[model samples]
Target: MNRIEKRLEELKQENKKAFITYTTAGLPDLQTTAKLIFAQEEAGADILEIGVPFSDPVADGPVIQNASYQAIQKGATLTKIFDMVEGVRKEKCEVPIVFMMYYNTVYHYGLEAFVTRCIECGVDGLIIPDLPFEEQGELKAVLAKNEASPILIQLVSPVSKQRVPMLLENARGFVYCVSQMGVTGKGANFHKDIREYLAAVKKESAIPVMVGFGIRTAKDIEPFEDIVDGAIVGSNLLRILEESNYSVDAVKEYVSGFKKELNENK
Candidate 1:
């Protein structure tokens, strides 16, 4: 199993929920990106999702959009992002890392080439937001060709209830249960029936199920504690960095605080 699979399975066995963190690559420069990766790992993040900045980040809200734009402006290309991952791996950060990118980014990079690079970079999984469930066959084939290739992570939402089973048919790593129907951002209002949705997902998914999208605070995780395996915090982390003037120290402080709250659930 890849790192993501092994890590999530370990959490499940330990009766501990995952506390995942996502940040855009090359944000304020790749140096800071590398630092952020290690900081989050040091602070008890179970898994790390590194976002590859695309020209049009449709799934991202303002916080990530602005951060991505600045990243691209500072030359955050796929090659450089992969290099950052390789560097982080060399530093002995064993936490599983997943790449969150658009299908277009992977397409232009060539399917075989992309998967090969992912294996080389030590990425454990992929979350391609725009990739349709029905259209994942080609990518899946490429991934299967390599033993160490990163797994494709599936996403389920309240609106996709009817298709949850289909979307999760051959899901690897863990299932990403989108907490809301909208784009990624921080908000108190998740789906009205999020608890039910999460329950349904748990019933349908054979692998671990994690909730994301609007998850902002530690308290948000409490609601899903019984229903899901983990909570993924996104946009608000960028807000923390911005508020702290992009300090990696602040990111560690924030993740450390949230992890402390997560441990209390057990």
Candidate 2:
């Protein structure tokens, strides 16, 4: 099994929910991004979703979009992201890294070439929010042949009842359940239906259901702890990193707060 699969299995066995964090690769700078990643791991992040800065990040909220634009301006590219991952690997970092990217980036890289490079870079999985279920067949075949799993984001809206199972079947590492309907970081409050939606997906999915998109605090995760397998914090982490004056120490501190919250709730 890949690192992602193994980690999820371990989390389940230990009865512990994963604390996943997302950051735009090369944000601020490549070195800073890498440092933030290490800090997150040390601060109790189970998996790291490294966002490859793209021009049109439709699924992202303002925080992530701004980060992507900044990273792009700083010369972040697919090659740069891969090089960053390789650099981290040279340090023997064992944390699982999932490239959270858009379909256009993969298309630009060529599907086979993209998957090949991901395997070569020690990447654990993928999260392509733009790749719809009906269109995932070719990518799924490539990933299966490579022994790499492509993670799918399960957006919870009124339409999820029809789409969740289809999304789950194609998903390998875990099912990312978006906590709200709109974009990545726009939700003001967790909807009342979130618990019911998580329960429904959990009942139908064999993989772990990881909640994301408006999750900022441990309190946000408390209500769904029993119903979901993991939590993903993105916008909040990105905001913290940006507001931290690019201090790696600040990044670590923010992640530490989340860690404390998760543990205290546990």
Candidate 3:
């Protein structure tokens, strides 16, 4: 199994939920981004979802959008991000790193080249927000060649009724279960309908299901414990990065606090 599948399985065996965290690469700079990755891993993050800077990110909210913009301004390209991943692996960090980017970036980078470099750089998974389920055929084939192949994770929303099964069928690593409609960073609480939707998704998905978008606080993870494998905190984490002025120690403290809260709730 790949690092992602293995990590998820390990969590399942321990009866503990996965804690996946997201951050934009080269937000302030690549050096800071590298430091943040290690800090998050040390702070109990099971998976690190690295957001590649893109010109247009429709799925992102203001927090991530700003991050993307800053990174892009700093010349954060796919090659540079891959260099960061290489540095991460050199430091002996085994925590799975997943790229959360748009399909346009991947396409522009060239599919085979992207997949090959991902394998080389030790990226364990990918979450292409803009890639449609129907059009994932070519990319999926490229990702399936290697034993430690980078998984292409599928996403599903509350209103994804008929398409849910299709998404689940092809899902690898885990399913990115978006909490609500519209763009991310709403930070809204889950209602009864949301709970029901998660329940249904958990029932149907064979792989791990991680709820994201609007999941800001530790309390937000409590309701999803039984229904989901875990939750992803993006906007809030980015907000913390900004608040801490990208200090590694500050980011670690925030992540540790979040982890403590999640453990306490458990």
> Considering every candidate listed, which one attains the maximal TM-score?
1
**Candidate 1 lDDT (Cα, 0 to 1):** 0.88
Task: Please give each candidate's TM-score.
Answer: 0.97, 0.94, 0.96
Ordering by lDDT: 1, 3, 2
RMSD of each: 1.0, 1.7, 1.4
Q: Which prediction has more favorable lDDT, 2 or 3?
A: 3
lDDT of 3: 0.86
Better of 1 and 2 by lDDT: 1
In model 1, where do residues sit more than 4 Å from their true spots? none
Q: lDDT for each of the candidates?
A: 0.88, 0.81, 0.86
Cα lDDT for residue 33, model 2? 83
Following a full C-alpha superposition, what root-mean-square deviation does model 2 have from the true structure? 1.7
lDDT of residue 91 for candidate 2: 84
> Candidate 1, residues 1-266: lDDT per residue as tens digits?
78988888888788888899999899888998898988899888999999999999998889999989999999999999999999989999899999999999999999999999999989999999999888999999999998899989998888888998898877888999888877889586788898899999899989998888877877876776887888898899988987897787899889998888877758
Pairs of colliding residues, candidate 2 = none
**Candidate 2 vs. true structure, TM-score:** 0.94
- Give the residue spans of candidate 2 off by over 4 A: 148-158
lDDT of 2: 0.81
By summed lDDT, which 10 consecutive residues of candidate 2 come out lowest?
Answer: 149-158
